[model samples]
Target: MASELPLPLLALLFLVILPPLCSSWRPADDDDASVSRSVFPMDGDVAWVVQVSDLHISAYSPERSADLELLGTALRAIRPHLLLVTGDITDAKNQQRTTSRQDEYEWVTYKKTIDAIVGRGGIDKSRIFDIRGNHDMYGVPYRGGKLDFFSTFSVNSQLKRLSTITSILLQGDRSYQFLGIDDTMSVGIRFPANLFGHPTDKRIEAVNSELQYLTNHSNAPVTKVVFGHFPMSFTASSEKGQRYESVFTRQSISAYLCGHLHAKVSKQLWRYHEMRTTEGHKSSFWEWELGDWKDSRLMRILAIDGGAVSFIDHTLNQALQTSILITYPTDSRSMNMLESEKWSMRNDINVLVFSHQVIRSVSARVFDSYSGFKVVEEIPLQLVFSSSADRPLFHAKWNAENYRSPSPTRYWLQVFVLDSHGVKISSEQRPFSVEGKMAIPTRSWLSYLVFEVQWEDMYRVLMWSNMAFTILLLFTPKILYHFVSRSSSYQRWVMSVLTSPIQQRKSYLWLVWFLMEGTRSKPFWSCLVIYVLWLIEMPWFWGRATSEDGEIAQMYLSGWSMPFHDGGLTGNKLSNPDVLVITLPFLYLVVIPVIVLIYGLFAEKAIVCSRRSRRVEYSAGSANTLAESARLLPDAPRALLMKFSGKMVSMVIQFWGSWTRRALLLACSITAAIHLKLCSKLMSAYGMVPVALSPPLTWMPLLLLGAAAYCTKLHGD
Candidate 1:
């Protein structure tokens, strides 16, 4: 029995660390996300394209939909070669309910906005393409809005739609070829119910069939981009998507564009070094997710010039008539910019950066990749390669050679630009591989040793596993003793322990209480101890962590927020540390009493089972469900289960339920307010809702507390 518990307890402990293990590593910002280099086309025909997604049009707000119209009107003047809408054109989520899956009004609003995105600007409707998002499916928790999404675009006859289009400019050359995927799924009332990627096998086959056709067509556009609603990580989590990516690696694609995670952009780049059969080899594409227009008003401008692809983030100014085209380092995206500090002093690495707004200041920051990303040198880029009176060009030279390294140093150049308008923006993480005493990677595209897993990372995992198993191993003996020890034997043991007649009766009774009920009662005090521990741990965790955890990182609404890693939830989720704090108090509140009730109900069965092993045969009528003693449940475990469940339920109702109706209502109202506040924080962090809205709502819990106290004083009936 003791052996039995170690395995289960070890399993339980394993569950404890699983959150951080499988978690999606979320970077706080673009600078934090840039450990790897951006992948680009080495050579290709030039084309300028604009990609936007996750409209989430609210029917209640025409001004919200008007922003999309304003962007379309402005883009017509810029005349980008292609315009693409990835997914979630409609906001199906009910306005008030966090638990709501979708509704119809948002769908109708999206239908109108889609029209606005492709209005009369010489932008053809054929050039625009869209696919279904998880919100479009709206199949989680509620199924009423499943068909509502299709009404926005009535072209689809089947549930799933697939489309491939190639656009050509005046010269009749292949501009850009786009492949659209309808990858959507739904379940119910689960964290992963809607967010977990579940691609059907048939859909995978159809997508593969299309890719095969593109593979055969040599005249196909060299710049290939696949537009899907879900991010690559989400898709790969599915069985169908795994098969699709496997086939996709063989097919040379420039980029995989997606936009389910709005208000944020994530880029993941990887290189294939396999010497496998295929005409196309040695190419990589970065999956770029654009922010949402509904709240963020952000769009992406992808420019393909011959052999290079550069992306610029554009913010739509609703107050102004035209869109604001933001600019940064555009020239150095393709070249071997990764140079050693030794080489930098010998030969200057020229960086060309231009912005639409008036210049303020520019500085170059060099980060050491080897030494835990320590800033080896920070130099203000004073050497202006060129100056402009009307438009300011930002340029800076760093003394890279001054900080030369013996080993190949992994460093990156980040240019911070301040505009005259007091707006500051950072350049994309330009991670450079400096050649040094250590061998440098020569591959044109940056590569990291993924297969050569970092032993440190593995060791950390194993260390946690061992620690958990050992901690649980410590508790196995007690659990076994509790399961086996009988009341009479326990009493005898207590009497034997009281051999010291000098011991007072009060001390004896206290000892008995400590022995029997300490485990149950200590949890109450443990909660208080945890609060103090959190105070100690907060600073330690802050200094120790590279970034805060999960949705909390994006929205630190409270001074008392605990970090929980994501990826445990389920899209990139549409998903702890204050986990022990959040969990322990509830376990004390709910589990201890439930456990005691179960033990009381099953004590009879335990004694009966123990007696069975001691040569005592249970008679058919003696132990039968119909004739067992009334002191115990006369039936099986089901009867005991029901009796204990009733006891636990009755205790809660009899005790806590004694509160007046107003107090009960106030408690429920406060709890509901807290739940909505937490949900809004996550939704805003995920870019589903406006970040501005989250701040006002973050104060809801505090307001509710004040209101509760006031109501209590008023003594409302």
Candidate 2:
């Protein structure tokens, strides 16, 4: 086969495969290694920042008021150097989660609560940073308009723009640089239609410019951190087709902190982005997604000890007694090695404890993982510093040079805290390495899910994958039917696998045949009609129209509006594939086809079961044996061939008759109903009418579902 290939074809193959194999990659150099800085200190050199996100304060929810008060209490207790609220400062939705509307009272409440907290806690307004999430941009026409409540009331609004760069210099000349990015859409379309982070080309270039300026002027060992509202996966590309990850990797960001998806989405979303730049230097960073503060009352404490960074997410409450965070000798499994070398060079193990009660005792417990994590040594730590407002610091001298090894070895460490009342609280035992190595085997399996997935790359994959899958689903059956009569080995093999009684014994093969058979049913055609009609226009909803230059003419948007196209009623130009365009098509066109196909399967099953009493069915095992024997001996008899065909029909009928399959069909219908309702609400937010209720904004899905169900029953009868 290789010898027969054309020269151009061979050359093209090598062109596609050679570059990645030939490239050399190495990790980007750390700032600490290049710059001369003071040796790691015991105290004062370390600083902590507090991050609280998705507060969603509103008049409808009373608990949010208490959450704000609890935050103030916690801030007074910990007294972090800086505070970061990473967007969705106000819940932009009504009491019902279905509609999206911006309320100024909500922003006013947020502003007042934050002002009270700042007054009570003595936190400088300049040290606090806030950015916008999707909820923050609902139904706004432009950036600084009267409806842009974020511009009027947000913390960063005091400085003119929400996106900002702020630097803090700790004792010993150690600097921490924080970059806040605002990637909310310019038009601020209504939600849940505006579900992605959209940054203009200028915004991306501005970020690049700011980071470049900081890198050029800064001489001290700086710990760079970026804060934003959206995770990399949820953010869309800029108009210039640039992503934030490229800037983060090039700038050597320590971590990108965010919170949009709360606890239910995933308990913890930790992504490690390792990239090789075009210049052949490898760089990496961590994207840490914290839980929401609305319901969970979550807050994150991020500490920078020397140049190393570590963080802990904790729930805030009125009665919480003690919270502990080990700053020095960071966790082996989670720390980014490229960020700092201080972890291996530090001579002391330091822990910060925030408590209301007087801390009477502090100790460090070490365990040997090779010996079944048995307790090996317990070092008594002393209270190094205690402030009336800030958290107390405890330290113990230890020689990191003594624990160096040829390869990585895990050493589990835990800190125990005892108050004056004899209440003991301990930190979770986390593995660490003196060699600054990773504990690969002990890491969570979910961490691998986040490895090496870039923002722009994932966006393209989602866009192309949806298009490819939809086209294949619609065209495959037609193509297969046309070629079924040809003498093709591949087709013959596939048909044999789909039809053979022995092969049909496998559940997955039967499922494949069931879906394949369903495309020929009447319900599938009914669904395809609606789906094709949806594709013809792709109209979502109607709303106020705005131009590219922030011009809002009371000219209302009408007719079919394609979000993907530059020419539209909305007057917004969007060329790249975003979550908004990609996800909406998938929910409407892609999902309905799948639901109808499943209903077709159940309808066919119903017809099969009605005729069960008329004909006797054969056992799959016995029938398969006879069928195989007849195929091997083709000249044996015609009666044997007829019996084989009948056996196949009976086997297929049995495949559809299982109680498990029936239950699954019913479950799929219920799931489809729920999915349809969700899509309906999303569409209605954009001006599309619903199926049942007056105003036509909330009932269309239920009506369509009823029609599908009625058609299924008619086909069955």
Best TM-score among the predictions, by candidate number: 2
Total residue pair clashes for candidate 2: 6
lDDT for position 437 in model 1: 27
lDDT of candidates 1 onward, in order? 0.43, 0.62
Q: Which stretches of candidate 1 lie over 4 Å from their true place?
A: 1-44, 99-105, 139-146, 151-175, 186-192, 219-221, 239-245, 264-283, 319-479, 482-717
User: Could you give candidate 2's per-residue lDDT for residues 1-717 as a string of tens digits?
Assistant: 233224323333443353321011111111111111111212356788899998888779968865677777777778787798988888877777766677888988888888888987677776677888878877666567777899899877765444333333344457676777766666566554465666555666666676676578767677788888888877766544678888888888888998888765654677777787778788888888888988888889998877778888888766456889998788776764643434446678989898878899999988877789898778888877544335477899987776565445557889999999999999999877666776544335443443234444554455445544554554454244334424467445544654467634677655554544555453444445345334322333233322222222221111112233232224434212333343545444535445544545444554455445433433455556666767766565846676767777767666665544455457556755665565566544543332223212223334444455554442333
lDDT (10s digit) by residue, model 1, range 147-168: 4445335222121233322222
- Which residue pairs collide, candidate 1? 43-307, 44-306, 44-307, 341-400, 341-401, 342-401, 564-576
RMSD of 1: 18.9
